[model samples]
Target chain A: MSVIVTPTTTGAAGAGDPTSTSPAPGAAPGAPAVRSRFTRGPGRWVVLVLVTVTALAVVAPFLLMLLNAFKSPSDYSTNGPLSLPTELYTQGLTTYWNQVNYPQKLLNSIVISGTVAVAATVISLLNAFALGIGRVKGRVWIIGLFLLANMLPQEALVYPLYFFAKQVGLYNTQLSVIIIFTVIQSAFGTYLLSSVLSTFPRSVLEAARLDGASRWQVLWRVIFPITRPTLSVLLIFFFIWTWNEFFIPLVMLISNSTQTVPVALATLQGDRLMDAPTTNAGALISLIPCVIFFLIFQRTLTRGVMAGAEK
Target chain B: MSTTTQTRRPHRTGTPRQSGQPRQPRPARRERSYWTYFLPGAVLFTAVIAIPLVYNIYLSLTRWSGIGTPKFVGLHQYTRLFSDELFWTSFRNSLAMIVAMVVVPTIIGLVLAAVLFDYLGRRFRGSVVSVLRATFYLPQILPVVVAGIVWGWILRPDGAVNAILDAVGLGSLAQDWLGDPSFALPTVMLVMVWVQIGYPVVIFMAALGRVDPELYEAAELDGAGWWARLRAITIPQIRPETYVVALTCTIAALKVFGPIFALTRGGPENTTNVPSYFAYTTFFKKLDVGYGAAIATVLTLIIVLVAAGFMVFQARAERKDA
Candidate 1:
């Protein structure tokens, strides 16, 4: 690594006088002259074009879906996708609502995602608090076990969990999805939160303890306030993860009424290749909550990253 | 003052031990408490996750159809998999996608982070970076079905990509992206990249921020150009994070079922049949529980090996740094 550092200084000195016969300091005899790649005129434009092209490529599908949601089925099928919709359409929405029971499914998704996020955050926060701040023994082993549990693929567990859920009579229930999502997410949450908490200054915690605060009270009053931003970031992340979860819900939630948005939208495709507009509408509806959350919590998300950076 | 006063005045009272000896250890109090912190998490982990992982290994060894009693068939499924053409094909496709999904996106993410970090100042950088990140992350937040539907519409024969190609008078280039066997896996890989790039970019940005500004200053003084500085300073600084992202992306790529299930269903002549999707079909569509378990077991092993490889690499890197 240090080998490259000297070349940089030589390159700078070389830039000052292109005709200089003398070797610059730190320059090896006959070393190649370093040039400023950033100063190359066409490269900047090329990078700009590349960034724009990549952004458009990434965003185009989403924009198409959003626009298609506003087109009638006939218009969507016949008209060019890039063209303006001939008429604004609510028919797709109506079809989506009726076919997928969109309202009920949306409610189920919200309830399941919400419950899972809350439960996972709470449980992980407790674990993080105990292990992070409580000076608990064997903390490294516990954390390692959590990581091991997380790394196991979901498919590996689906069959056994199916039987287990059935044995416990929780299969095909929203509770099953909630519990499954929560358990899977808690490991990640605990890891992130513990890292955040360990960075917290110990003197503040000690002050609380000396002031006659119990462990729980100190956690609630002191640690919670300090870590609120990290907690919120985790909350949004967990909510998004649970909302977007597929395989667990597919394996466990067997009935239409209990099906979340992903499963509901997936079943919409079977035997209905022509129903693009309605399926697009369902897809759009499924995305709105997450988009809203993203827009709202974007600050905390970046700040959390910045915090992790500082560590 | 309090400590001295207590030591001087406390002996006026009760027990024999209070005068001369130190107190006994608090064994009674320790015994009174249960290990409650481990209770809920441990139970859930063992029941929901751990047991199933163990059971999956067991199932991989049996010949059960998921209905009746299992016949003990040791290594039969494994032996069959050795000659399974579809398994190898899917494995190859998975390896291709892993490269596409992890390697390409990671480079793109690092470049994007570097560009944004260079171009934007601190305050504006923070806000703008998040907005940009949110755009990429939006697809990931949507259910795979939704994303699949959206991408399907965009990539259909006469869909958005074709429409754009037609509009630009390059109609010759337009093809049925998802329906074409040559294009199906690539299309799915593109979607996976689109869905995943935001995460790694965020991680990279975080890692980039940790890099000391003095290093950049030193590089500048040394006449290091942007690319040179990036190669020497930035890449090495973010190597650990890069490893983490690569490991996670590989695991995610291996286990990718939802998008494939939603979009291709391993179709266009099974060009996109990854091991996970193959396992899904084997169990659900074929009702071959043991075969499916064997595939799943292999995938689990691959992920574990990749993770271990990363950890070992990271440890070596750290040792060199030390």
Candidate 2:
């Protein structure tokens, strides 16, 4: 949570108007001394209430989904999706798990997302190292090209990719999904890493070189070790993004055995329309991994997103 | 090229032979080797995205069902798209979605972030702010399919929304939220707003950290209230972050697919059809590959142009800040 707290600490410490003739408390005394315009009055309560309501609205749908996931089919149908279950009714979940082959689909998602995350991080690391710190020619133009590719909508590419993959015999395979995700995700990965590396001290690399280390050795042994945090941020980003990716996998992985969790969840909805409890179970299944990953990497994801925006 | 090669041959061989002399490698030589590091990423990106994009442009000019050889039709699809009411409707819906996803969220997120940083910053510990921020961001991190499913159930006629409305004695206000064309688009946009608000809040909070609190304090001393302080200091200080939020959210709204697919499937007389969902149905469902490519090409161009505009604005803002 350092990523979340760092900004607040720095912001509170740096709090003070530079143009004021009177001395600000930010520069004086201890951490608690840095202060101005402390929250007071009825306005403070109003702000708290407003923020709390908004927060509830944001999470209301998920809460509804969770509540319905445990409801029996009859209860869900009779009471609608908002009511609490008399007891934990898991028959819908059991049916969904058995019908969809939950273990296989879950494995597919794990393998696909994991491979994409690892591969994207590795490829982007090399690309970022080269472009950010190396004396490569036309690096700015290359980075621009990557950014341009990054911005293009997926629709423009998915159809052609479908045809191309079919022609090349890579269709209906997890490899195709992995390759597509790694390439698409690596653009932002390269951008984030390159920005981080640009601010890194060059003297460290120089010192490594002066010790007679090869360039690859220095990159692997020195750069990789020092930049692990940034790399992990990219890794978690690729995992979350690829896990939720829908369109490409829908096009590429058509078979039930091959489809990822999102595709399976989507197709399951089509098959089980109006089956609220079953649909909720599948939705919960799809969301569980993302929520777990998010809880684990919440700070890194926030920092990574802010880093892109700051650039 | 032949003369350069001839001149460099002796230098290259001579350097290798003189390696025992503890001589430094030329900066130019060291720089040239860096391209090797870039080769893998560059080649993969080119193969996956760059080539397919170029191929997509070609496909847009042809009448292909994505199976056999494409018949060259020479911009027929584009001509048809220009006159297609559905395409225009989808485009308009995208603009509406942008209002919900980009415009409203940017405003709300900025206000919340400013309040958190200015008034609440001193009143509470940092963890409270973090917890509040996380709660807002929870929807953003959920899978779009999960979001779509939850919202679909909630927006059903007899679903959670209506149930809640009934409990509050506002039962008359409840309607078939997703099934009605007029209500569908707005409901989807509202969900988009809910999913998107946390992004700007987090970014703005980070940006706000860079603004010297003294500015807010100074404004307060001048009898500026909370809103005035936000208008004077918080907004200006976080301008670049604002552009970032706008750019990302606009692109997201334009390319949105899963939510529409799961929630409405561009239904209720296609009132909620955005370009991405429209393109998907045209290509995959209708098997009209050429038309899909055309729609996609147009969407890509719009995003590129919008992004270019945002970049220019960001650069100018940075220059001013500098």
Candidate 3:
């Protein structure tokens, strides 16, 4: 597992150049030296094989689901999974739509996710601006508290939140889900935004202040434009997170009418295991919006979220 | 009032000099008012985060079911947890998943980053790199339930995987991927790896970008091979990133719940029950809130301990370097 092979050959090839002439005799001049380094005769094949196997392993399951969505139950069970369908089928879609209440569930998910994203983004902006720009006292303590809150698992807080929602008469409502998600996500959003804000030049804000702008005007005019890219990134992320969230929706929204896509999908799994195609179709439907969202915001998503440690 | 304001302007400007010269009289009045701006945010933070955090800790110690008044149960839930085979099994499964999720993905990510770094360099790199990263990260942003459901269909007995296996004339390899006890945990771990690979890839790529190209040039001049340069320069340069990814992924692996909940539901003789799911089941399904809290509290402690260990190790390493 821990093979330590010397790369002396490649080194030798590099130093053999007449211009360098500093090292060993076997060194070659200016040729892209290939030492059969990790990707040697068999290692190349081995690595390729592993990558192919892993890719297949990753891709095969989704492909299977996609194919299963087009197959009849009898066809799926009797025929080999890899085999061509005996005939085309659409019954699965109809079954999935009716059984899972796909339209209503999808609508609920979109509304809740959109609301949460917008609310979280707006709240985060305000909080970030206040903390980032305003010379508030105890700023460190406030930011530290938010960071600590982010570290706690949502599971630990969900129960009390549920009770709190019930007490406030927002239980089983989309508003309740939206509020909870927004508030929970705001902690992290504020942190990210504040970091971005910190990177903004203080001199720009000072100039704006000297221009006779009020505090609100300075935030609106000077700060908001510069932070649009960061804000958009946060919006996309918050949207995806809220859209993909499962546990909170599962716990809080027990009513079938209020169920989001994931909760609805899970319910379908529990209730309709017998109908493989319908379940597959339901799962596929759930994946569409996320795939689209991902495609649209892929750049910002990766850059904003992963760039921290990447740097 | 206008006359007084006109007279006070000169005194106001003079106040700073008087205070500086006389050491501290009028300035004390302004200092007392400084706390006012902090009042709102501080209060909101305490109300939303601090109170709830304390409540969660308290809940972790109690016997309150979702529907009822609480009873005090001193360490009984914890002691019972020690004897619970399911808890231990889930904990072990989580540990295995962590190794699979963190170690495998980090290696794959590093290799992918190296390949991209060599191929793309800088120009036109951004677009291709972003697209690939997004594709890989797509699954992670999807709800775990969705991921589980989608993968479940793919791994079904006659699902996509088997279809491909049969098509390729290697039909013997196909099995009930999620349903079979032998394949369930590994199957979940693989899905996790696929969903998770993109995050580390982007991270590694960013780290790779920061590496000075001159080092590679110097290494090349020194007759260093690709692997030599990578081992000597690349790995050490990105050590901080590696630590961050490892710690974060480990915590994520331990807390995994949704995929297991959606796909296996800990089926095929309870093979895929991770600790998070175990706690959920014990609380909600089994209606043993106290026991579940015990499991959750233990899980939290484990995470905290691991995180603390990483921080301590990192600090010591940094100190040694210093």
- Each candidate's interface RMSD: 13.7, 9.3, 14.6
- Please, what are the lDDT tens digits per residue for candidate 3 over residues B1-322? 1112123345345434433543422222222232343344445555555565566567667787777776887777788889989988998998878877899999987876665453332222244444444445456666778778777767778567777778789989989999899998888888778777866666666666556666776787798866887789888877867777787788778877787887788777989888888877776787767677677778877877887798799879867876
Output candidate 3 Cα RMSD: 10.5
Worst window of 10 by summed lDDT in candidate 3 chain A: A1-10
**Residue lDDT tens for model 2, A1-311:** 11222232223223222222223444444433224335335777777778888788788777888898899888877776666797798887888788778889999999999999999999989998897767367776887787787778899999978887898999999999999999988887776566556555655766777776677887899889777756776687688788888989988998989988889888877665548787878788778888888777865655544453453
> Residue by residue across A1-311, what tens digits does model 1's lDDT show?
00111111122222112213323334444543332322335555555555556667777777888888888877876886776788889888787778778889889999998998888888788777766655356766887777776777788888778777888999899998898888888887776565555545655765775676666677789887767656766677688778888888988887889998878877767546446677778778777876787676555554554553354
Q: Which scores higher on DockQ, 1 or 3?
A: 1
For model 2, residues B1-322, the per-residue Cα lDDT tens digits are 1112123344344433333533644233243378899999989988998899999999899998877789999999999999999999999999998999889999999988877666665565566666787788777667787788778878888788999999889999999999998899889988888878887787777677667766876777778987888888888877756776788788888888888988899989999998999999999999999999999999999999998998788778767877
Q: What is the lDDT of residue A62 in candidate 2?
A: 79
- Candidate 2's DockQ is 0.40
Rank order (by lDDT, best first): 2, 1, 3
- Per-residue alpha-carbon lDDT of model 3 for A197-270, expressed as tens digits? 54456557666656666566667897776666557666776787788888778888998899998898897687
Q: Which segments of candidate 2 are over 4 A away from where they belong?
A: A1-43, A299-311, B1-32, B317-322
TM-score of 1: 0.84
